[model samples]
Target: MGALFFVKHKPTCREIDIVKLTIYTDYSLRVLLYLASKPDATATITEITEYYNISRNHLVKVVHNLGIHEFIITSRGKNGGIRLARPAEDILLSDVVRKTEPDMDLLECFNPKTDNCVISPTCRLKSMLYEGRSAFMAVLEKNTLADAAGPITQAKSGEAVYVNISRLKR
Candidate 1:
């Protein structure tokens, strides 16, 4: 009854399918897309946090992970902050999703030692899950950060923020 967003039906014990993205994944995608749209804007953490009005605390880990994955480069100096390692077109959404959702194993029964799956030896779940993940990425691969930023580029609902794609239309 005290849950923040999720509310259990209490009558049905349906396995709560976690088909949603995590904040870590969410922020990574948002930040990367935002940065990619900025076009030569090497924005700082403070500036980004302010633009999106997101918590700097949560974004810290996301930014750090992005740097480690080589999707983005970070530096400290007067002209240093964070910037894309490669061009926006070169960086695929699938790549970002893959790096961000590293632990997206659908089932744990595939493990050898503590295999919870009773049919571990012949279970097809692992293969199926792999296919599903692949298919998901296949869809995402078709679009780039520039594509996902469709509505974001149009109609000013508030103050001017960095990377407003709406303003870039020719």
Candidate 2:
């Protein structure tokens, strides 16, 4: 008998990373946090930019979108600035995320219009991912800007103290 050989095919599907918020959402949250930290005062874009050490141009767009969504109120000219349109306690994190994120689809199969997966119709993975995403949103829905905008902590150098995730593994 002739020798027979078989080859196993590697999956062509890309390995998608865990769900993440967009930079716009991050900036929006940061702006809101900065504003919430100073409840009695209005903040200029320049001030916010300087405080976070982020891009002014990007912050401008974020501020505009926040204003359009009625999350924040903005005024122009001297003595004019931005302030929260509503109390931080009333602004749910999930609402901000939904409004700012252009797309929330975790996988291609999540969107039927663009889904081209051959196994999508019978895929349990899609349903599992949907459940995971729902759980993620549910957690966010339970929290508000007030819960996230706790006291600001800074280093001795007056810089934001960022957690080192790798160190936490120990």
Candidate 3:
């Protein structure tokens, strides 16, 4: 009698093609972009909510997280508002994505401690996914908040005129 064992197989590109950021991360980037455009002034959640037409409650949480991560500075009181903690040029897009994203694991096999897949031990898919993720992050690491914010125009009143966030190309 012989014992049977399972063989590991490499995943196809299509099998490991799922890569999507959470809405929270998207909102976090939006907040950063908005603040980057208004570098000289602070902005309130209400203003951002109105501009993006998103839920104020969701933005409040995003703002709090951004503050906690030191991505933005928050002030309290009558004149309170939020602004970038540092210059937009100094803030890396990769850092924001890492800070805002709760989980970056591309698949169940990426985390060894929690991974229970039979093929995880021998699978090449995890390595391929790791390479893909690394390439994606490398692109972000090369860019800063200022790069994503694009150009900031000024109105006749000297106020910063920003691109319409809602109408931005996805």
Each candidate's clash count: 3, 0, 0
Instruction: Choose 2 or 3, whichever is better by TM-score.
Output: 3
lDDT (C-alpha, whole model) for all candidates: 0.67, 0.76, 0.79
lDDT of 1 by residue, 1-170 (tens): 00111112111112334445556777887788777767577888888888778999989899999999998899998888998888777777777777876454545543344455556568665677558756766877897766665433333686434445523535
Clashes of 1: 3
Candidate structures ordered by TM-score, highest first: 3, 2, 1
Output candidate 1 Cα RMSD.
7.7
Question: After superposition, which runs of candidate 3 have C-alpha atoms over 4 Å from their true positions?
Answer: 1-17, 152-166
Q: How many residue-pair clashes does candidate 2 contain?
A: 0
lDDT of 1: 0.67
Please report the candidate that would top lDDT against the real structure: 3
Q: Where in model 2 is the C-alpha error above 4 Å?
A: 1-13, 151-170
